[model samples]
Target: MISGLLLLVLVGSAMAQRDLSVDCGSDGWVTVHWRPGLGFSQTLDQSKALLGTCPPSSLMSEDTLLFRVLVRDCGFIQQVMEGRVTYSNMLIYARRPELPIITQLVKCDYDSPVGEESEFSAEEPDENREQETFNMEIMNPDFSGPAPSLRFGLGSSIPIRATVEPRSHRSLRIYMKSCEFATDADIRRATQVHPIIANAGCLMESKSGNSSFLPRRHSDEMRLYLEAFRFALGQKIFLHCDLEACVVRSLNVDRKACHYVPEKRRWTLLDEPSQSYACACCDSTCPRTGLMIDGVSVHKVLGPLVIVENEPESSGSPDSRASSAHGMSASRVWLLVFVVALALVTVMGVLVISYYLCFWRGGRLGYRPSRDLLTKY
Candidate 1:
């Protein structure tokens, strides 16, 4: 019964959507729209979708894109379009954005180099370029400015801007590979193994700084917006990004990768540069996700990296098979007491009835003694 109730709640809590269109091609684009309350039409983009953008390469390989849009706005898009607009051969996902933000890890499609390798926004670059290495800087969420520390409560959206150095007057392309919630254990395990977990959720990709100065060596920066509401109080967050400098030998090459350096106490270039990661990093499974941590099995459904407090020791145990003695629960003990009291009451009532029938009503013992005494008198 409990399982059924849980299933119902899960289904009911699912995000609702108005499917504008069903089938979409890989190379095709999708136009998503939503009406939150009355007549407000919400404008959406590719970054809000689960699979991000499905390009020609993806559709060609997968045949068709199984697409669905959120029936409301998710508070990610800023533009407003009148009603919902439909495009030729494009998929649609429209929904209301009324769900609470939590530490949720949403599944996203894998990153691929599908689009043409050109300057972002179609501006041609000069032939003579001689910059070798570049740097990435996160411009948004400001990182407490000079303090170099960042702290935010739940339900806060983190907008990331990673700028490349040598400054390309044009824009630079940024590709986000993965984003996930992890603990110190998970991070440690992942570092030991090559290639991070591929199936992690909340993936996004976009271009940045297209309309900057020209004749510069650096490309445009990459911007990533992450909405964190369901994260644990102190859990670590990890982000991975790949920056493409240019298409070389039919490949998108990144001369310098970017990641947060722990030892330096700042986000800078190191031997192992990742897209982004929190200070308290881990790579192990959480105990509440039905995984055993430190030889303890946890059966509860806690969010990612959530700390379990006052947990039980062996919640369900069986040890009374051989022995006759078994501990009774509180309810069982109360039931036993009630049954014994009822049995005693029934026995007393039967005894009273027998006494009335034999001694009082039938006069079996009283009449003989009285007759002998009266005859003597």
Candidate 2:
């Protein structure tokens, strides 16, 4: 019995070691490590470490606990290798599928002590008593040129590419917000979100040919790719993007520039303000451009094109032609069966009729002693 128990324990340990899947629903930020020779380089869960999702117990607030890592170079590499590096990373936290409509009484019940009086009123304040203002600012930096119009084929799985040049900044990061409606207000609402579209890292000038800017510049020249699947198919999606140019500091320090505020239940930009060249980079003096970088130029319409297969000229519509072809194939099978049945019936009938006329009737026109000269018996 003890030996059996030991074997079971060993089996359980083996299975546990193989189960490397991440539980994002865990209570805290789960830190995962990946090495080159750990039998596997990286798992899907490890690769998605950048996706910062809050635990169930964590309040859905504007403030999120950010995780950062610092890596030190031990020695110079002796071999050269090629790989594609992703400059832009985004954690898409879509609003919960179903938001519970909690009444003020429910909130008060949760926050207040069991028998204590509340300082704040349980009733909601009148809307006419106070006016709230959301600063609709276009503080985001401008592109060097006009935003390009893009057309994508439906189900193609290709991304839209754009290019922008940042001035007086360490890096330029682009965040996209899309809405079905094309109204300016709807567009304004999209910019307040945290999903990033592209990030052009710090473009600092350096004399060395091996500077990171060279690779970034080359990549920007190549294209700023956006996930095309973000837009719904067969509709004109209004894309409003905000460019946060890291002018005073690098992106590594200003990682909180774009995030959702759980307390307010709204998206906000923290840590840094959007860049504006005309205002000397002052947030107070600068007028927010309603998240429009190039005025109307920043807005774009993406139409998902439908791809149709080429069909040969036929006597009917494409659908009809297909149906006719199918019908013809089915009829041909039936006709071939009918012909085979007729041939089989004909062969059987011939055999039966020949047997009756020759063998049963003795092959004689009149049954008179015929063939007497040829037969010996």
Candidate 3:
């Protein structure tokens, strides 16, 4: 027995040594630190830290574990590093803006090589690289100032390029606002019309102060392209020309305001509104009948139309339906009260009967205790 107890104690002691700690700090920006193996740890901020410790002597089940930390918008613009710790390795990840921003890597003094190096050596800096400039006058400039203004269609596709150091990863983002509109009543009368203002094939390439516009084509494809272009132009006019950024691989067009009916069935275009047919049945069978905007037969019995009208002063709006609902709620409340009262009365009746049996009778049914028997007890 003593030997078994000793073995158990040794096993318990071995289990207590496994744990992990994750430390987090922020100066101008956020920094996360991971201590050598405990189990798992994550820190959103120094004040808010998450530390996980496993049971002692637990075998390493998984090598890598993913954790998420949320930071409410902090306006301080900088890259934040998140740290992770495992049994044999420590890892750090960084988060930056969605758009392209300058990133700098600060090497640690005690950094050691992790793997074998390749045979290729880094390239020397190019001294003969020359910059080019273009001087094309704006035809219909919108504004005349230090920065000249040039107009581009709402749906014009522009090419973007970026140069970064070799073996380095960089991201570029551009934001743009697009608008589209159509005024042709025939097109408007169609199932749905998406205006096109600029052809998608139109290409604009830009570099520092040197920009070039590709040749334009007015072919049949270009005519089809105008449909999309007109739509974008209409949306821009509707929004009053909101300025937007042009991000790489990020082209988003906002058309949240446009409302077009679903294309379930085609709508007929009517020439005369007076010639529309009326429902033959009365209020119950067919409540109303009207022509849809596209002149399709719309029977109100199939779907009711909701209308809001101003109330008159004379007819003081007494919501009889609301009052009826309140009455029903009050009836339910009274029913609950009656049920509770009946239950209370039932419990009191049972208690009185029990008291009478225990005190009035000498543990015998329909029998009363005599005075002499009571005196002897």
Per-candidate TM-scores read 0.24, 0.24, 0.16
- Per-residue lDDT tens digits for candidate 1, residues 248-358, read 111111122233223553332211232222111112111111111111011111112222222111111112221222334656888999999999999999999999998
Q: Which one wins by lDDT: 1 or 2?
A: 1
* Candidate 3 backbone clash number: 32
Please write out the lDDT profile of model 3 over residues 274-341, one tens digit for every residue.
21111011111211111011100110110011111222211122343356568889999999999999
Off by over 4 Å in 3: 1-24, 28-174, 182-241, 245-377
Write down the lDDT of every candidate, Cα atoms only.
0.28, 0.26, 0.22
- The stretch of ten residues in a row with the least summed lDDT in candidate 3 is 1-10
Task: Provide the global lDDT of candidate 1 against the true structure.
Answer: 0.28
Any runs in candidate 1 off by more than 4 Å, and if so which?
Answer: 1-148, 166-172, 179-181, 184-219, 247-377
Clashes of each: 35, 13, 32
Q: Is candidate 2 or candidate 3 better by TM-score?
A: 2
